[model samples]
Target: MIAKIMGVLNVTPDSFSDGGQHFDIADAIQKAQCLIDQGADIIDIGGESTRPDAKPVSFKDELVRVIPVIKTLAETTDVPISIDTSKPEVMLQAVESGASMINDVCALRVNGALETASELGVDVCLMHMQGVPKNMQLSPVYDEVIEDIKHFFAGRIEACISAGISESKLILDPGFGFGKTYEHNLEILRCFDEFKSFGLPLLAGMSRKTMIGQMLGDRDVSTRVTGSVAGAIIAVQNGADIVRVHDVEETKDGLMVLGSVS
Candidate 1:
């Protein structure tokens, strides 16, 4: 029955979707407010583009792109802000700037990231990505996708706990498109409840992803709103506590309808 929505606000020029749309600080702020008005429970701000083949941005550049927006939103709205990054430095700065959650694609595998999150004392989402964004889609392989990611999450959770982070502060994301083929993504959705065995919150972010496109007639990113909402609905029904999404209003409406029925 959980239908928390974490609206994506990517402030990069090449984020695969709505990238350049929010590169300007004012525009990003406006978009954040729009997401908030649309019923986003959390505004997830990403500075760098993690899309496949995305060129890497310097740490300083990444910080510049996200910190101002986080600071502005923190001052203007009380909504929980999530910083989506893999770097330890960005995590620290984002928290200091008022981000309550760290949505890391690398699952804190980077050096010092676990310790940093522990020190910051914020909620952390550990996502399962097979490889880096640059080459993640290049022949990704897995003997059992769900089992593989479950093991990865277990190890990362252990690492976080070892680093003095409380277990209550952890969330898990299956990473629908980070490094998976169409079949792999579907399998994760089908077996999402198995991940809840850890008794932690589960976040599913299949919004406007290639998997949805591939499943729905190769629709373009902008034309995938219905598919994204469908995926979000399926994720929520399959034991997801949170649905990271772009079409917040549509997803919210869908969840409302679902709530009345079930």
Candidate 2:
């Protein structure tokens, strides 16, 4: 199946990629429109930078950053809007502001997150992260990354269901760079089909990440577009249902070419 594209719109100055590029609300709204024009199926607006060793943003600040963009986009676009946040308050306000999906890196494990998502009645993307963003990459370890992620997804799915969220409303993200080494990220991509056994849509976010840089001779984030597109194609070929990306036009072009021959 062809994978859907989720355009990355970070309204923060600290994200690993495209930070400070759209920190302004007007710039963010323009970027969202550009992504839609490039054939993005969803727009993911993130207020906080969840990159490794990233400092946390307060609830008030985060809400102030993302809510306006979400509200404006909702008024102007037909594409689904996803709020990339783990905070329950943000989730609630974002949904109320017309965000249709909640893309949480914490897999709704934070206190009251699951309940908030459940009550909000929005689709949720439960991602697998080894640790908190502040220290996720510090000596990361895993006992069989694929199996561990599957186990983690299973537990999070059960928890979502137990909290009154419909099983059908949950999506799973493998979280390629969060708390993962280069090898772990590769293994997850190579065995991505294994996660399809759960019968949920899989989301892969590998655009312009360190994993791509590691393979491209430590290329800078801005220079990793080609590698990012190649990695995104591999992930789609391996059964990724949604690909979160920084280069929306390039990645969408790649998917279109691949789709024609698939």
Alpha-carbon shift of residue 215 in model 1 (angstroms): 0.9
C-alpha root-mean-square deviation, candidate 2: 0.8
My TM-score estimates for the predictions, one after another, are 0.99, 0.98
**Native-referenced Cα lDDT, model 1:** 0.93
The 10-residue segment with the lowest total lDDT in model 1? 1-10
Query: lDDT of model 1 at residue 143?
Result: 92
Q: Clashing pairs in model 2?
A: none
Q: Which ten residues in a row have the lowest lDDT in candidate 2?
A: 1-10
* Per-residue alpha-carbon lDDT of candidate 1 for residues 95-198, written as tens digits (9 for 90 to 100): 99999999999999989898899999999999999989999999899998988998999999999999999999999998988889999998999899999899
* Residue-level lDDT tens digits of model 2 in 59-120: 89999999999999999888999999999999999999999999999999889998899999
Clashing pairs in 1: none
lDDT of each: 0.93, 0.94
